[model samples]
Target chain A: MALPTYAGPLERTWYYAFRTICGLIFFFLIAPLVVIVPLSFNAVPFFTFTQEMLTLDPAGYSLKWYQDFFGNLNWHGAVKNSFIIAVFATLISTTLGTIGALGLSRAEMPMKTTVMAILISPMIVPLIISAAGMYFFYSKIGLAATHIGVIIAHAALGIPFVVITVTATLVGFDQSLIRAAYNLGASPTYTFFKIIVPLILPGVISGGLFAFITSFDEVVVVLFVGSYEQRTIPWQMFSGIREQISPTILAVATLLIAVSIMLLASLELIRRRGERLRGITPS
Target chain B: MAAATTSDGALTTADGIPLKASLARAERRNRNRALLLVTPLFAFILVFFLMPIFDMLTRSVDNTVVGSVLVRSVPVLSQWDDSSGELPSEAVFKAMVLDIQDGRETRTIGKVGTRMNYEKSGMTSLFRKSGRRAKQIKEAPYKEALIKLDKKWGDINTWRLLKRESDAQTLTHYLASIDMRFNDSGEVVRQPEEKQIYINLFIRTLKLSALITVLCLVLGYPISYLLATLPVRTSNLLMILVLLPFWTSLLVRTTAWIALLQKQGVINDFLVGVGLIGDDGRLAMIHNAIGTVVAMVHILLPFMVLPLYSVMKTIPPSYVRAARSMGATPWTAFWRVYVPNTVSGIGAGGILVFIIAIGYYITPALVGGVSGTLISNFIAQHISVTLNWGLAAALGSVLLALVLALYILYDKIVGIDNMKMG
Candidate 1:
């Protein structure tokens, strides 16, 4: 808001001070994330900037850490496991969550509030508690230390996001479209595929992205439930931090930062698309 | 036709069904379809998610180790009174010797020892040493031989401990979780001064979580106000700054903090280069309480901001403008009009941040040194390092109770349906 011409000196001073505080807060949010990008390329294995780096000398930077990350067999295995588990978990959670969200958004659904709470409890409960419980129970059932176990656990964790996003999209949906399609002689399956799926595709895809990220970044549950054979990227990074302080981790963090940026951009796109489909213009 | 007729002039459908029954049938079909769609997920969560947590709750009080392993002695010891100030009869000693011998052969007596050790120290070694000598004792007056082998066997407290732990269900783990234990007379009391830790850790966790919540509000409020008041295009652009961290990998953000906060890291190097302190005086920020508070405030600030922004965006500016026009001071206008409207936002963000912060694990473990560590770290340690699953489960139950309570509060203040993710 622009200052009014009749504003007093005190108002003017407070306005500038407020903006300054917000600027610093914004810097606090973004600086740590941006600071690591430059450090990841440091020529030395250290975490700080060197004298040459301050002067913008090309000699002070190197891609050796990236090379190290790419060449390590353990990192490769971790990457493979991360994608495999995340992909499967995302698929399972997306399907189950989409169906559940449909029911949750229906006006006729029974015990809707309690059911929603139970469905979302995974997101609400502490991760450590979930991990400990899963470790004991999974061990008893002969599922501990197995890839399938980790996958199922991650899938369970991812369901809430899918349920949330998809149900949000369904909230704005027009139910009459389904009835109209049925009146036009389309079968229930055909109507769902044509009318419902197409309309909610954006929500489903964004929800799937959420589920994917949830699985990919998860470490605690995998630490408890999986063996070394199922080590994911975050698990590897956890041990890497604890066992050895290495610059390669910085490189990996940089890569993950890139993934986050891409995901954020895609989520924005999906949000805008869904809004447009629902005929809501940006203010 | 008469059976289908209603005395109160109820309407009938085309098929001679009453109109209310026909409407009810349609509604039931819709409800069944909705329930059908949801059943698979509900059942899946029940089996995979809820059951495991319930299993852990059961494990917290699952005390069958001593009962099963020391089968021969539990019954005999249950009859002997510890307050009598006398040793058990020879039959009791005979039962103990046989039990120890059988446990040693089965290689399961160590579990009993570990469980007992939680109640009283030195019981593990007592059990192991006694087991080794029990098989060799082949004489009458087994009590004398057992006492000669180990003076601990003759101690009256040893029998008391055995009697207490032999029950199928016990509250000892739960007691120890809160730093309370059964005294000599079986009354629950605080642990010895040096041994009291879990209660303090719980307090620290709550205190730190509250501090972090307050910090997030202090930092988040101004920015959220700025975003809410700015032009839509500019605010959307600035919103990226908040969402980037929200979307970033938790470990990645934590790693960045390590790079920034370590003694020799970026912040220190900058300070040293500017002559703020001697090179040897670089601060130890990482692995401490300061590090945890700083990093977590940065991480959780977004949770505070988003809710506040959404709420603030809905508040009409006319009320504040009207207050200013009515001769109110700017501070009064903002506080009396604007701030009151934002209290719901504060409550939602506060409880959300506190709930998440209390259960935080990775950030504290990575950055929080011994003094900075939260209760979650201890729970993890018990699970992985100490292999004390029961204690971990007890601690987790306590933590879960806390979070559930807060979560219910959050739902009351800000409905879960209103929880939006960026």
Candidate 2:
């Protein structure tokens, strides 16, 4: 809103000042993210800007660190491991969580609130406790150090997100549509596949993406139950930071930052599309 | 005849089936379908999540090692009355020697020693040192033989501590987690001055987490208000600023902070270049509490903002305008009308931010140097480095309890079913 005419100086000052304060906060939010992009391209293996970089010299920027990150077999292995764990974990969490959401939205579900609290507890519990408990428990059950174990552990952690997103989509759903489709002589399975799946597809896919990201970003559990075979990107970065702040890490960080922006963009588009489909879009 | 016909009319379906039986079948089928849909995930989480948490809680109370190895001594020692303010009799010492020899032969003595030492300091060495020399003793004055091996054996308190901790189940790990220990005379007592570390760490964790929550509120509240008040076109563009960090890899953000806060990092270098400080006088920020607070506030600010923004969006601007039109000043109108409506939002955001901050692990571990560390770091140490799973489990249980308590509060104030993802 523009400044109003016939306002006192004090009122006008407060409006401008409020906007300025908000502007500073927005800058604070974005400054750190903006700061890291330039530093990742420094010619020297330094976190600070070199004189040459400040002067915009031709030799001031390099892709050597990016090369190092891509060329390292360990980094490649970590990327591969991350994909393997994240893919299986996303599939399990999305399927199971969608099913759970379906149950919870039903009118006849028993002890629905209590079961929901139980389902969401994994997200509420601290990572350390879950990791420690899983460490001991998995070892005893002969699940520790195996890919299947990490995948399952991550899937458990990711279920809450899936249930939350999918259940939200179900809230806007018209339950009558299911009955209407079934009344046309279509089977229950056919009605579900034809009606419900299409309506909830965006939520399902977005929820699956969230689950994938949760597993991708997870590190503490891997540290506890995983051996060398299960190191993901975050795990590698964690160890890399603890041992030495290699510039290659900065390059990888930059790359991950790009991935996050892409993910955020896709989620925003999915949300708008879902809202339109659910008949809530404003003109 | 009229009442019976009316009852028959009410109970029958249009298709001639009894309505009571048909409706009951439908309800049963719906319930079963719901259960069928939920069973796979319910059973999965039960095995992977709930069971492990239950297992960890039990570890806090599990006491099996000491009794298994010192089998003969525990019962005999229980019979001796150390309340007379003297060491147990010759019979107790003979039993102890026999138990140690039994433990040594089976090589379970070290395990027993380790378990006992967790209860009383230096007890493990006494056992270890005595086990080596117990083999040379071949006589009836075993009491003198043991006392000569270590003067600690002559103390009645040591024997009392031993007997009290020998129960097949105990609370030792939980006690240690809270920085309390059973004293020599067998009463729960505060740990001595130098040994009082865990309680202080717990307090520091709480304080730092609270500070981070407050910081997030201070920074996020105005931003959220702006996002809510602005036209949708501008606010939508500005929303990415909040979501960017929310979606960014946590490590990338943390690494950025490290690079910006280190002594040779961006902020320091900028300050030094601008003559704020000498090059040699670079400020220490990243590896301490300041680093932890700054980085965490940045990371968690979105959590506070998102909830507050959602709540504020629903509150109409007309309330403040009406209050203003009534001759109240803007500040007065805001304080009386606007802030009260946002209480639920504040509760939701504050609880969410605080709960997350309290259990934070990676940020503090990376940026928090010696004095900056939270309790999660120590929990990590015990789990991986120290190999004290029981103590780690106890620490974890306490942290989990804190989170769950706040979680219940959040649910009461803001329904857990309302928790959502962007």
**Tens-digit lDDT string for candidate 1 (B44-107):** 8988899999999999999988889888888988888778888888998999889888999999
Candidate 2 TM-score over all chains jointly: 0.96
Residue A95 of model 2 has an lDDT of 96
DockQ values, each candidate: 0.83, 0.81
Which pairs clash inside model 1? B287-B369
All models: lDDT?
0.93, 0.89
Which lDDT tens digits does candidate 2 get at residues B319-416? 98899889998799989999999999999999999998888899999999988899999999988887777899889889999999999999999999
What's each prediction's clash count?
A: 1, 0
What docking grade does candidate 2 earn?
A: high
Cα shift from native, residue B422, model 1 (Å): 1.0
Candidate 1: where are CA atoms >4 Å away? Answer: B1-10
Fraction of native Cα contacts reproduced by each candidate: 0.78, 0.81
CA error at residue A204 for candidate 1, angstroms: 1.7
Q: What does candidate 1's lDDT look like per residue over A209-256, in tens digits?
A: 999999999999999999889999999999998999899999999999
